[model samples]
Target: MINSIIKLAFGIEYDGTHYCGWQRQREANSVQEELERAIAKVANHVIDVVCAGRTDAGVHAIGQVIHFETKSERKDISWIRGVNSYLPADIVVRWVKVMPNAFHARFSAVSRSYRYIIYNHPYHRPAIFSSGMTYYDDFLDIDKMQRSAKCLLGENDFTSFRSSQCQSKSPKRYMMDLTVTRHGLYVIIDIQANSFVHRMVRNIVGSLIEVGCGHQPENWIGNILLRKDRQLAAGTAYAQGLYLMLVRYPLHYEVPQSSIEDFFLIPLLS
Candidate 1:
């Protein structure tokens, strides 16, 4: 008799401060590597996980989603509790569910969102919210940043904003939304897209910061898109400030929904 196959989906959040990235790397410690080891302890067998996005080193995530298949039959809560028992304190399994055979953590997702948090205060650096935040000492014009970001809202070839090491075949990606807002001493940049190129978020943020800080004109953003040259854009921003805020799948998948607003508004006070 053949054994039945069980596919599972999990929601996880991680503080990526000390992690090399989401993908397992041979030379460095990785979140995926650590999570897999924890799962192996519970399953008593090897298991591979597929995540919605492969965040870069030092990047964080609040609503990362992953899927894996296992032979062992385990309760939903058991997967959470069991996995948590073995994982480091920085990683947490928020939810677990049995996914339909067709569900895929990466492919089934409709869109992904990221938030880049910037500490704009020139004199004082924040004690908390430091792990995934970028600090800028220059005075930034919020109004110019908002208008400049509007130029990136529609589908376009993002070659200028993609990394040279990117493996995607095409630089084209659809931009669902891009918003720049300020809350007290923090400037939050929220972006959603069908997908992204490697370091695309950081690259875009870097250019936007140039505009925000008066290094470039508001219209310069559109001009950079036209150039299609990576060298013409600003340097990629630090990975510390970027967060994989959420990944959205079709409602049919029955996965939980997440809000960008609530997640971004958490108090930074330690």
Candidate 2:
């Protein structure tokens, strides 16, 4: 097959609060649309990009991967500055580069890391604003949260945390690790897995929070996993506080960046 496609991969970051999600949509604001507009201005032509993952509305990403095809052969093109200048303050192109045509941004990825943030407080919420902040009075016991998250390793069916909108054909996946830590009033839960259902991470976080709050037994986490039913899981957390932290690809196909900034550096609550 003869192809004239120039595959350009980019690292992106966005607040996601002001947009619908990563996918393109009609009438609704989306990160995809905003990104395409900025990139078009930079490349001086039409370009459509596909992301490794499509986060929900109000979600955020510090380091997300996307790929697009263009015929322009200018490797020296100034897309970084040009695209950022046109993009709204909430979204940005951190880095961009040419990639092998065989690399699929989503499918080529090996794993993804995600995080959930909780404002645990007794009398107030948690102080987490760059401006005047409310709901700033809670505490999360990190040690307890960590202890409660230990049941989530190895391969298993994650039906308890799956979302109704999830399109995956199966609920089986591997969880590499899970960590619960606290920085001030922020309760951060980090989890890495081969893949995740739409609300799996959030639902797991909710259950962990419940365990920390003494609502459920420590062993209840295992029971939920064994239940294998979405309805039996804890409530899915809000999208506003979740983040698509990282996407790992083979080292050979990795994009070379001076400073490879990604979602791992992002604060859980931000």
Where does model 2 exceed 4 Å of error? 1-4, 75-77, 126-139, 256-270
Residues 1-270, model 1: lDDT tens digits = 666888999898999999989999998999999899999888888989999999998999998999988888888888899999999999999899888999999999999999998999989776876776999989888899999988888899999999999999999999999988887778888999999999999999999999999999999999999999999999999998988989999998889866766684555421
Candidate with top TM-score is 1
Candidate 2 C-alpha lDDT tens digits along 151-268:
7888988888888888999999899989887666566678888888777887898777777777777887888999888777678767776777778888999664332223343443
TM values, all candidates: 0.96, 0.88
- How far residue 203's Cα lies from its native spot in candidate 1, in Å, is 0.3
TM-score of structure candidate 1:
0.96
Residue 218 in candidate 1, Cα distance off native in Å: 0.1
User: Model 2's lDDT to the true fold?
Assistant: 0.76
